[model samples]
Target chain A: MTKRITKEFADLQTEPPEDMKVDLITENDLFKWVVTINGPKDTPYAGGLFLVHVILPNEYPFKPPVINWKTKIYHPNVTNDGKGTMCLGFLRDGEWKPSSRMAAALEYVRQLMIEPVPDDAVDPAIAEEYKNNRKQFFKTAKQWTTTYAKP
Target chain B: MAYTEEELAQYERLSNDYVPDAEGPLVSPRQSSQRITSEYAQADPVYVHKTTTLPQQFSQYRTVKGDGNCGWRALAFGYFEALLQTADPSRVLGEVARLTSLNNVLDSVGYPRDIYEDFTDETLQLLKSTAATLPVHDDGAALLASFNDSGICNAIIMHFRLVTSAWMKTHADSYVHYTENQSIQDYCSTHIEPHAVEIDNLGLQACIDAIIKPAGIAVQVLYLDRSPGEEVNQLNWPAGPSTLNAPYNGLSTIRLLYRPGHYDILYKHEDIDILPAAAVTNPQINLMSGPVYLSSSNVCYSQQGLDIDNFYIPGLMSAGVSLAYSTDAYISNAIYAPSALPITSAATDPYSVPYSEPPKAIVESPTLEGPWNTDRFRPSQYQVEVKFRQVMPVRPEPCQTEAMKQAGESKAHFRNEDFQPQIWEPGAEYNVGRNSEPNRRRSS
Candidate 1:
């Protein structure tokens, strides 16, 4: 398990995903990581840097890692509460495979921001507004990004 | 958060179902027969049929827990068990060398040494120490305890998984067709290399062929499934050089019972009995020969129940009896001439005589002719007489000649080109060459 974690960590450092930066929470603890993703251009959350907490389990590859958004933003897939869990399909228990890499997983999260899935949403109200009132949803999403995701 | 009832239920089931406990025993003892009986006793017709045949076919089965790793666990347990059977330190040492060399395979596949080195080391260390203590009979319990250790067991399983997966990747063309047209890389990433993923048949075959068979060990997988068959299906690993050819010589067999989604170690009643020194001299011949009778015993009863008297070929029956008592020596002699046909009729006609009367025809025919005559002085002639009297009941003969003809034709078909032994070359279209573009994609 440590071997897998070390390999993933090295890979992450050497060729980190575009516009994303990851740091270990502490030198001794390889299990927890602080990741920041700069919202893609052309999206409402553009110019915002979103913080995500990555917690890998002891059985690193066998078990899927837990990723939570530490910075709040209006989105259909991310929960609005303090525990902003993202509901990505691949992270689901049955769908997750040990061969899935951290870089690929993080890239998937970035892609989700470009086009959020409303059917499988963590926040139904946001999903409904995004579906029924697209302009208003973008306005509120931009406002929240400015208020909470600055820097 | 919003989820449909079905999604919620699925999530609940996934969280509640068994997650393979790493600390659990690597291999558990054979559960009671009642465990299988209870599951199938009143269930589907297919299961009931399987339950009925299970007892006669297998004396007992030791299970590997339903952890997604059961396939790897079962194979590893089988490997150690085969080694223990040899009780030869040299063989264990040989295995250690073989495993060490296999690291090259992982390297060829671009698996970093740093990632898998510790696990491989743990496996090789265990083998080295086990070999140091030869005639591992006394230390059997301790050895099993070591296997139960989570770190050691998981490492060994992972090593085997990598070896199997590497073999598949290297020889991709042979297996890609079976993966529903998926490319070899896609198949390996999804099924073979993934941790906690259950192995499919192709992966199992690759493991047996690349790892176990090369170690000179044969595995007999008893498939207990819902297929419409009176007896369980038996597949020998490394599948013969050709389906018609016999398994590699001098290879000890490890029997595994395969259920729908799980694998367990199978034990024959004789496996439990302590063998005499003489019996141990040639264990392979003894083990392969026993299952033939065990499988046939059920077939005999079932055929009788179905009232299929004509299905019995006296010649084949006599050959089976002779092969059983005298071993392969009789088979070499019997293969020479088509004399078994005359012997079959001459042998089967005596059941009409009273038990008090000696089988005069059988005795007279063999003694009247000289040893040089093909009809006389065959070992099968004597064994068949004895076996026929003891086990065979009187039944009307079918067209024995026609049956023999069909059997001969089937044997010829097995020798056809389609059944030829497959040889995998590294640069073949199906195989992933070291310098191939796909190889570049794999590393990336």
Candidate 2:
């Protein structure tokens, strides 16, 4: 329900996660959220600012929110298309629980940037490149981050 | 490489319309038997076998709405139903106190007190009012009405879910092993705490341990899955010790019907005398006998606990099958005709095995006046009187030795001493460890 979402939004606002900022794009709609995550150091995305668009369903917590990468990134788990979709196992329809909050989802995305799971990757080509050619994978990822995800 | 459009469509249809047959009442009137053959007429061999055998063990069941919250709703309904059977205001008050105290567990588990307090308060208020009104109006109808109210019911059930989740979180070390290596917090957040999340075995166990066991109520979960068995597997949530080794003679127990993903309530015909008001008002027409069909659903108002004498013979005779009566001693006995019939009577098939001793005498005041008389129906040839035993409230003294007593005393002491709050220490090392775990896949 929106009540739980409002509580979660308030909780996140009071004590936002480290290096992450959350904002409502419109004053009327609490369902749509704009989240900004600071890429963890030591990853190819280090120093990059990735923006994520989160759209909560009417059945908010029961169904998982729809999340898309607004910023372009070259990651094994994230698609490099216009949608820039991220494949989070927990965010999948059957796997999502009402108790899982937007904060946890965002944190999971940050973790994915740090260590991409090549095994269950959305982008098959990127996954293959990451698994077989680590150097080239890191170079392209860093280049994409520098070009598209610059703060 | 991926699922075809047809496959995706099929999956969507299955997900959306899976429980079409689950549109019954939250708790339906008891049926004569489980209606096994009719219910599972379309089911496969495994379900059919289990369903057929279930009625042999359990006489009646109440269907619950197969909404996502069926598991919790079923358990809550069972808890209240069992509580009403006790008819003791003190027991209801005890539940209030027990539920109130669980807030401490929630507090320790880092659940914001303000967030969960209202839910708990709602539950406590409902219990208090129910207990307060017991002297004037104490019946299953009141309990059912309370449960049917979505606002009250949802609040109480949610409180229970939180309590179970908090209990699991508090006792994470014990439950973590059962989660296939998922951390306690993660496990609770995803499975136990969520609203509308169907309870798995571990979650069910946690609830039994936290709520039902402590409240001194036992529950038997009849598993009617596609398991190969003539008899359904029953898991008892024992009232004492909460261990497999403990003896299981609990004061009260309610039966739960468990299909693959849903749970509904089951009632023993002999245990509770008063049936739901709806069933009592509109008795289903029994085709075999003009007398009220003694199917599990027929609410016979008898104070003397289900009088086997009053059990209708024509119905059983018409079924033309010897029903297995699973008593404590004569579990192997293939048949038991509740009515007194000649050994050679059509009701008593050749396979009807007589018990060495009569069934245990159930102590209840014989109040209901019925049309059938034991004197008129008594067959001179065979007189094997079977009495269904009611679970006595007395605790077993033999099991409580000095060591066990000391252990029980120290358990309370250890609870305070060993209780550790699960606090996530936000430190650099913790972050590093989390980021570096390549092989550690998060459980979805």
Candidate 3:
């Protein structure tokens, strides 16, 4: 498992995916990683960075990494407060494939920003807002991104 | 989908109230499949009908816990078991090379050696150890123990997942028809490669094509469902590779009883038929080893009344219990080709109840109520002719010569209060000579 993690960590560092930066939290703890996804261009949340926290369980590749949003954003799929933990379909239990790579998972996380699936949202209020009122949704999302996501 | 706070609380309560689908060993020890029949004995009519007929074909089954890995575990266990049944050390020994070579398929599909080799090595090591117990005479204790160990079992299952995934990917054209809606790679990634996802039909077929079929193991799944049928419908994959001359090889089949969402291993009586050297291992009567035995198609030979610890197979022991089929059929065919009795003809009140119709031919005088009522019939060309009347124990006559006893049970031994002295009862409904000829049997 350590060998697998080391290989994954090295790959993430040398050939990182676009719009994402990943680093181990501490040299002592390989399981805890700090990741940042660049908010996509032309979206209301553009030009801001969003920090994501990831904790890989020892069973890893066999299990999925535990992830939460550290940066507050007005996204329907992510929780509005607390740990900001959320679902991305594939990362959920019973759906996570052991063969899935962390790189591909992060890539999926990046795509989540491009297209927030309001249909499967963690925040019903924002999900409803995103669906029912697009103009107000963009304004509030841009405001929150500017306030909490500027680094 | 998101839920309101109240809905979330209710959902939480519901989730808390729910228990898991299946819980037990990843794979369990073998058990009498008759237990399966009685399990559904009180269930819906369909289940009762299907399960009652289950023991007719499959005599035993080993449960695989319903933890969503049943299908994979059943086939994997079956593969190892088939290797044991093939009984050739070379065949069991030969699998390591065949399995290791399949790593090439894993490689071609880009499953990195690091991720998959750990599982592959575990698989190979298990096979090597299993092969060490060459000419497996005892019923697979070592194999069962290995599978019960979660770590070893999970690794083997994981290795199977990898192999199946790779098999489906490289053999894309073979499976493209099944995955027309999505790319084969997409289907493999989500369904075939998932550790938790239970195996679906396509995945099962790919796994068989990849590992089982090439190894000369026939696999079957008995779908015990609510579909219209007197017995469980079955899908069969006949014995692998025409070159592997395993004729009349019942043990090679990995019969799985699929009940909706679960899969359990099923075994024929032949599976429990111990090798001569290991006859003492099983406590059950060694029917095959016995010099004279009686069986009847009319009677449902059920072990339902067994005292788990001290139970004898019905016909082999003294007949304290009486069971009869509706029609007088070949006594041997019931034991030999148990599947021959169509569920339609065999009345639903199986096991203990007497069929409404009288037997076409009676082995013992139909009116015989005497202590020793068994008949001494002539042996068929294939085997000895003896019909089971377990209620009365067959006693050898003191005056009979040794040669007379071997050729046929001494006619003196079969006599009762009403035993007719004549060999052929002229114009009688029960003809002794015709009944003795097993090759020609009445349909009803």
> What TM-score, over all chains together, does every model reach?
0.61, 0.58, 0.65
Instruction: Please provide, for model 2 over A28-95, each residue's C-alpha lDDT reduced to its tens digit, 9 standing for 90 to 100.
Output: 78999889988889989899998988888776665678888999989866666688776457776556
B227-333 per-residue lDDT for model 3 (tens digits): 98898889998766623222224436788989988899988765555321121111122222233333222222222232322221212111111112212222222
Error of 2 at A62 (Å): 4.1
Residue B262 of model 3 has an lDDT of 83
Evaluated at residue B147, the lDDT of candidate 3 is 89
Which residue runs does candidate 2 get wrong by more than 4 Å?
Answer: A38-43, A46-49, A79-82, A87-89, A93-101, A146-151, B1-34, B42-60, B64-70, B84-90, B114-158, B168-198, B225-230, B238-252, B270-272, B275-444
DockQ of model 3 vs. true complex: 0.25
Question: Which residue segments of model 3 deviate by more than 4 Å?
Answer: A23-30, A38-49, A131-135, B1-21, B136-138, B242-251, B274-444
Top-scoring candidate (DockQ): 3
Q: Residue by residue across B1-444, what tens digits does model 2's lDDT show?
A: 798644654465457435445576666656755575578977888877777767666677777777667888888777776655543334555577667778889888777775676567667776655544321223466667777776566666778888888898888776888997788878877776666667888988888888888766788898877777766788887774422221223546878888888888876754544322111111111111211112232222333244333343322221111121212222111112222222224246443444233332221112222221122222211233232111111222221112223332342332235534334444432445645443433321
Clashing pairs in 2: B30-B297, B31-B297, B32-B295, B32-B296
In model 3, the Cα lDDT at residue A142 comes to: 94
- Every model's DockQ: 0.11, 0.09, 0.25
Task: Kindly indicate the candidate among 2 and 3 with the higher lDDT.
Answer: 3
Given candidate 1, what's the lDDT at residue A125? Answer: 73
Which stretches of model 1 miss by more than 4 angstroms? A3-17, A40-43, A74-77, A87-141, B1-26, B31-35, B44-49, B138-143, B238-251, B274-444
Alpha-carbon RMSD, each predicted model: 22.7, 25.4, 16.5
Query: After superposing the true interface residues, what Cα RMSD does each candidate give?
Result: 4.6, 5.6, 3.3
